[model samples]
Target: MSSSSEEIRLAAGTAEVGVQPGNGCRLGSLTVDGVELLRQGERYGSFPMVPWCGRTRDGRFRNGGTLHQLPVNSPPHAIHGTARDAAWKTARQSPTEAVFTYDLTDPWPYPGRVTQVVELTEDALTLRMAIETYGDSFPAQAGWHPWFNRHLAGGDGGQDDSGVQLSFTPAWQEQRGDDHLPTGTRVAPTPAPWDDCFGMPGGVDVTLTWPGRLELNVASREEWVVVYDEPADAVCVEPQTGPPNGLNTLPRLVTPLEPLETSTTWTWRRL
Candidate 1:
């Protein structure tokens, strides 16, 4: 709703998204019915989707029986991959398109380089991040952490009514732990204070409908959705390839993502 400055604006129907490139990635701002969907009040910046949100014990990981140390960015843990703090090179750009590339062959803590492109189209916004291994090693896990405000979706902002209502298919419901991690085992009942990831069947649409016909739907290519409902005035309907911290658990849980391999596409559209 603010004056378009340096941000690239994409328009389709009545929906619009503004994109900015920096910090190794592209950040998007979506608006519908004159309300902003993504949380702009918080610091808005492009962040990488690697090294995960947390680190292994002691910031060390045993890769092929060798120990590697990653710099601790989040006090006791490494946060949000290496690109969150790394500068991304803008390879291509226009009024509505941008491509950012990051080479981490030796400078990065890991042994891979990534090229992420953020494209803004009329109907939706797409971010495609590709990680290619420089050597034989592979990446552990990767994902995007974009914040959204429910108030923009039509929440009344009343004391009791100003919350988000997430609509999922019958088979998607599952429980999670306190750290917002899934327990693998399924629960028959959906618990209160729910903060977990559900299996999002591909092509299944999940909608966040607000009061005034303002809604956002994510059609997943993967099979899961990470629902993060904080005590704040927003909800994060993240489309992830696996659950949070799935890389650091017993039996290894989800398979460790390999190089030249990509997670599924997470696409969002305003309705």
Candidate 2:
């Protein structure tokens, strides 16, 4: 629950909100009056990254003839890029908006840093992260991982009793092994425990409704949304451009861009 006095605050009705954008990561924290809307104790995890989510196997990829090896910090693969848990230099800050930037040079596979801007309006919060690659040959993938609490509907107290209901448009599902990595594929129709990614139906907005009719809507400019549930008090409604381990599946599930080229905007707003 520790926050800076100078942190940006936004209000929707009586809600007090805060945003921090640094080191290619953008984060939002919301509270109603003095009670937390999101999970306050878990607020300080990671800035949610440059590549945004996980990478390929071993962080190894081939661009032309050179095989680049990134730091494997996330066990089986390099997760959330290099800047997820990194400290970002604050670029700008105000009462409702904050911007943070990170620059990567030297031997890192990707040659440029990214800038992330987080804005808080009365009803919603938006985070936009952009990476400007210095060279044209680098591969890039980006998305978001936001954890939402069901307690937000009942004022942070009914988190345990509150159940989460999610609706998406996925025709198929990928099966993963014990390592949490994809192995095979299956046609998923019945609801089950999901840590998988799926392609979105065009123009269809995914919604997660809690006990008190409070809903979180995730609309994407990309093709898919990854719905991950831990079956606890919270669930992750991630708006992503590709599947997990996308680096290995680049130019397929992953979106490829050039230097200074930007990806589509992934947005989420509360309802």
Candidate 3:
């Protein structure tokens, strides 16, 4: 399944990862020793959020009782999902690991299938995603988004005080309303240029320090994690599995033998 772009490199010892199985199964970069934890182009690395993961309010959604219109493409709201922009299908690769596949046709009326795997070890970097359905029961969400790199690469000179340093302990904050979605009320974790949506519920752990150069540790068993650092260069840790219209508030259904999975793991060191 070509179409155009194709890169899939994965190393282990010095830790490198760049998989783009034609863009939707994106990553593009995640170096380690040479230090570049993501963020390098085409809107920056790490991308996957199948079936629906962010925004869909003005774009509409309502599976069982009808009402489905989506295509706002972030106009008033309809961001992220649609498999990053389609075109994925490698199904398997080697070196350090890879796998991509997509098949949820036409403006997305259901009849799903999405899989994305990425694995690089020796310091860790793992991502897995899944959503399956072929009949009935279908409402979904899955996540990943990662756009790290605020000045990675042995910092101390990249400025902005050497950039990257984000901690996480969220158990609240999701109150965003005013069209940016997420007003189910639950506030309290402020301080940053934060775009909002947090409620780790003990899942999605984050850390990304880069003071002496690297720290990275962004786990995720998924419980919603969207930390958009207001972008001065990059910082987007988005674990997501709901929160942002959440397909009309939080719907996760995907039946047809239970198929909805999520995973995120990015371990690191060297600081």
lDDT of each: 0.54, 0.57, 0.82
Give a tens-digit lDDT track for model 1, residues 1-271. Answer: 1122335555655656665544335365776545566776424432345645333344555555566666655556554566655556667676555666666643355566666666555556666666666555543655566666656543464433555566777365655654334556766637444566666555435677664445556655656555666647667665544455544542121222444323333344444
- Please rank every candidate by TM-score, starting with the best: 2, 1, 3
**Best lDDT among the predictions, by candidate number:** 3
* Segments of candidate 3 deviating more than 4 angstroms: 1-29, 39-47, 51-62, 65-90, 94-98, 101-112, 117-132, 141-143, 155-160, 164-181, 184-192, 197-227, 230-234, 237-243, 249-271
Name the weakest run of 10 consecutive residues (lDDT summed) in model 1. 247-256
Model 2: per-residue lDDT, tens digit, 1-271?
Answer: 1223234445555555665433234355665445444544424322454553555677676666778777777776776666655556677777666666777653356567677676666555566667676655465566676666645544455433656678776666656657665564645644756776666557325676654545556665666556667646667766655566765664322223543222333233344
Q: Report how far residue 134 has shifted in candidate 2, in Å.
A: 1.9
Positional deviation of residue 96's Cα in model 1 after best superposition, in angstroms: 3.5
Q: Judging by TM-score, tell me the better candidate of 1 and 3.
A: 1
Q: How far is candidate 2 from the true structure (C-alpha RMSD, Å)?
A: 4.3
Error of 1 at 153 (Å): 8.0
Q: Is candidate 2 or candidate 3 better by lDDT?
A: 3
TM-score for candidate 2: 0.78
> Candidate 3: what lDDT?
0.82
The candidate, 1 or 2, that scores higher on lDDT is: 2
